[model samples]
Each structure stands twice: as structure tokens, then as C-alpha cells.
Target: MTQILNGARKCFVQRGFHASSISEISAAAGVSIANIYQYFPSKEALIIALIELDLQRHRSLISRFWSTDFSPKAIEELLADIFLTPEGHAVAVLRAEIASEGARNPHVAELLRDSETGLIGSVHSLIRAAQRRGQISNELDPDLITERLSLVFEGLMRLYLFSPANGQKLIEQYYRQFADTLRLRP
Candidate 1:
């Protein structure tokens, strides 16, 4: 099952959701199409599974933040690692493919919506915790803050995708400016 998901993710990232065929995924997975179908009824099902897997990974990443001091520097570091690293670039590519599919497919759009909702909820909780710790301004509304932060992340991803060469520097500068706004004022 993991192999199938990994294969599907690779094929989708390389060839896009529509261009990738079951045969290609089967070859990538070292499994027969019959085996893949036994686990995932259709390509859409594979997409859902991949999204679910990404959600789980995101949840785990959020939990790590929960355990930390919730400092602006910590947040900046996390964001940099996610958006500026080589592994992160691959993940970002996959995310772009998923987002493109979402634009054309209602079901994929719904899944993406659900994933974003879950992410927002997690980030909202993180914001609330930071407020309690006096690391973030209590004047900020957690929900609104979470939404805007999500937008910032999406923008960062887009920027990185568009300009990989300058992504790290741009992300650092943007995040520093954004983090300054979030920090509790002396």
C-alpha cells in the first residue's frame, strides 16, 4: 500500500494527475495494475490516499510546534525547512500538481478544502498557544491570523515554485517581516 501511494505520488508529480496513467503508476510501484486496483478503486482514490497521507504528516509537524516554545524564530525555521529545502521542493511540486487537479476536479477541490481546513485548525491552535505564552499578540484573532498565515504560506510556495533560485532569500526576508508583525510588542 505504501509502495502504491509512493508510486502514485511520484507519477503524479512527474506527469501530473491527468497525464499519469495507471500503467505508469504500476511500473513505479513494482506492482500490477490489478494489485493497485485491489487497494485503490481508481486514480482519484489514490489521490485521496496521498492527500490523507500528507495531512497526517502535516498534523505531526504541527504537533512538533506544539511541543516547542512557539517562538517566532522556531516558526521561521520550520517554514524555511518546509519551503526552501530540496526535499521540500519535491513536496511543493507534488502539492502544485494536487492543486492543479483540484482546480479542474470538484472532488479533488473538496479534498483540498478539507486538507486546508484541518491545517488552519491546527495553526489556529498553535496561534492560541503562542498568545497564552505571550509570544504572539493577544490582540490578534486566532482564526483571522491562521487564515492570513495560510495565505502567506501559499504565497511562499507559489513564489518558490516560480523562482527556485531566489526562493530561500525571498522566503527568509518575507518571513522575517511577517514574524515581526506577529511578535508581541515590547
Candidate 2:
């Protein structure tokens, strides 16, 4: 079962959910069709499992992002890394493909929604922390702020992930300037 799942994730990342088939997954796993079925009843089931695993990892990253456990420069570095690094590119590629499939697949939609909710919750927690510390205006709603910020960050990331070489300087600038406009701190 583990072998099948590992292979399925790789195949899906390479070919996407819509294009990958059970036979290909089986071959990648070095398992037979019957063996694959012993764990997942269908390919959709396997995809869902993979999404869950990815979301768990993403949640960990989100928690770290909101902790403010580092200096301001560190945060800027983090954003730059997300947009300019090789690891970031691979993650973006897989996420872009899976998210595209999610647009047409109900199972994928569920996982995506759940993942976004958790991510937004983490961002909201950070906003609340800032507000409590008198860093942000008390009237600012954390929920709304987190949502808008998440959208902005994701949009910025999408732009840079596609053009890493030319995108790094612009992306780094945005991260540096973001605190000025988005902080909302008195």
C-alpha cells in the first residue's frame, strides 16, 4: 500500500490526476493491479490520500510562517525562498497541476478547501497576535485581513514561480514593501 501511494504521488505530480491511470500507477509502484486495490479502491482514493499528506506538510509550513519567530529580514528571505528556490518551483508545479485538476474534480475540491481553511486560520491567528500586541489597529478584523493577505501572497507567489530568473528582484521588493502597506499597525 505504501509503495503504491508513494508512486501515485510522483506520477500525479508529473502527469496530473486526470492524465494518470491505475495501470501507470501500478507500474510505477512495482505492484500489480490487484495489490494496489488492496489499499485504495480506486485512483481517486489514492489521490485524496496524497492531497491529505501534502496538506499536512503545508500546515506545518504555515504555522512556522505565522510564528514571527525570526527577524523581519528572515521573513523577507522566506518569501524570496518560496518564489525563487528550486524546491519552491517543484512544489508550485505540482500544486498548480493538482489545483487545476481540482477545478473539475469534486474530491480534489474537498481537499483544496480544507487546506485553504487551515492555512487561512493560521494567518488569522498571526493577525490576532499583532493586534493584541498593539501593532495593528484594534478595529481591523483578523479574519478578513488574513483572507486578503493570503490571496495577495498566493498571487505574488504564482507570478514569481512561473518566471523565477526575472521574478526574484520584483518579488523581493514586494516582500520588503509589504509590511509598509499591509501591516495596518498604528
Candidate 3:
């Protein structure tokens, strides 16, 4: 199953979620069609599994982030690590592909929503911790702030996927401005 997932990830990364075919995944996995179907009924199912795996990884990353001292600088550094690297771009593209398909596929949409909820929960926890530590303003509701932060990230990812050069420049500018704005102290 792990082998199949690794193969699917490779195909999705190389050819995109929509363009990647079952045959291609099978060839990459060195698994028979019957075996693939036994594990995953359809490509959609396979993609959902991949999304779950991604969510687990994201949760792990956020958990680690939350374990440390929460501050605007820390948030900025984490965001840079997540959005400014090649691996980050690949994950962003995969997420964008899933988001596009989610618009058309209700199941995918539900899965995406679930993943987002998990993301928001993690961010909200971090924000609340930062607020408690006087690292960020307590004026705004943490949940609302977390949602807005998520919107900013989604916007950044969209720009990054569609326009790389402009996106990198914008991310640099945005991260600086965002870090300053999010900081409670001078």
C-alpha cells in the first residue's frame, strides 16, 4: 500500500492529479491492475488517501511548530520554510490540484474541508498560545484571525502556483509585512 501511495505521489507530482492515469500509477508501482483496484476502487479514492497522508504530515509539522515558543518571528520562519522551498512548491501544486478537483467532486471537497479544519485547529491553537504569551495581539478573536491567516496562505499558494517569479517576490514582501503586522511588540 505504501508502495502504491509512493507511486501515486510520484505520478501526481510529475503529471498532475487530473492527468495521471491508473495505468501510469500501476506501472510506477509495479502492481497489477487488480491489486490496485483491491487497494483503491478508483483514482479518486487513491487521491483521497494521498490527501489523508498529506494531512497527517501537515499535522505533524504544525504540532512540532506549536511545541516551540510561538511568536511572529517563529511564524514567519515556518511560513518561509513551508512556502519558499522546492518541496513546498510541489506540495502547494498538489494542494492546488486537489482544490480545483474538489470544486467538481463533492467527496474531494469534503475531504479538503476536513483537512482545512485540521489546519485551522492547529493554527488557532498556535495563535491562542502566542496571545497568551503576549507575542501577538489579543484584540482579535483567535478563530477569526486563524481563518484570515489561512486565507492569506491560500492566496499566496495560488500566486505561487500560477506565477512563480512574481510569487516568490510577493511572498518575500508579504512575509515581511505580515510578520511586522502580526507582531505585538516593536
Best by TM-score: 1
List, residue by residue over 27-99, the lDDT tens digit for candidate 1: 9999999999999999889988887787687677767755665455675677676766776776778778878
Q: Which prediction has more favorable lDDT, 1 or 2?
A: 1
Q: Which pairs of residues clash in candidate 2, taking residues 3 or more apart in a chain or in different chains?
A: none
Q: Give the per-residue lDDT digits (tens) of candidate 2, residues 70-126.
A: 345666566555666766666666677767778989878877987787777777877
lDDT by residue (1-186, candidate 3, tens digit) is: 999998898889889888999999999998987889999999989999998887787787767766555454665566666566777777877877777778988988888788888788778888778788876788858776666556766787788886665645756655565565476454
TM-score per candidate, chains pooled: 0.85, 0.76, 0.80
Candidate 1 runs further than 4 Å off = 70-73, 184-186
Number of backbone clashes in candidate 1: 0
| RMSD to true structure for each model, in Å | 2.4, 3.3, 2.8
Cα deviation at 74, candidate 1, in Å, is 3.0
Find the candidate with the highest lDDT and give its number.
Answer: 1
Which of the predicted structures, 1 or 2, would earn the higher TM-score when compared with the native?
1
Ranking by lDDT: 1, 3, 2
In model 3, the runs with Cα more than 4 Å from the true position are 66-77, 165-171
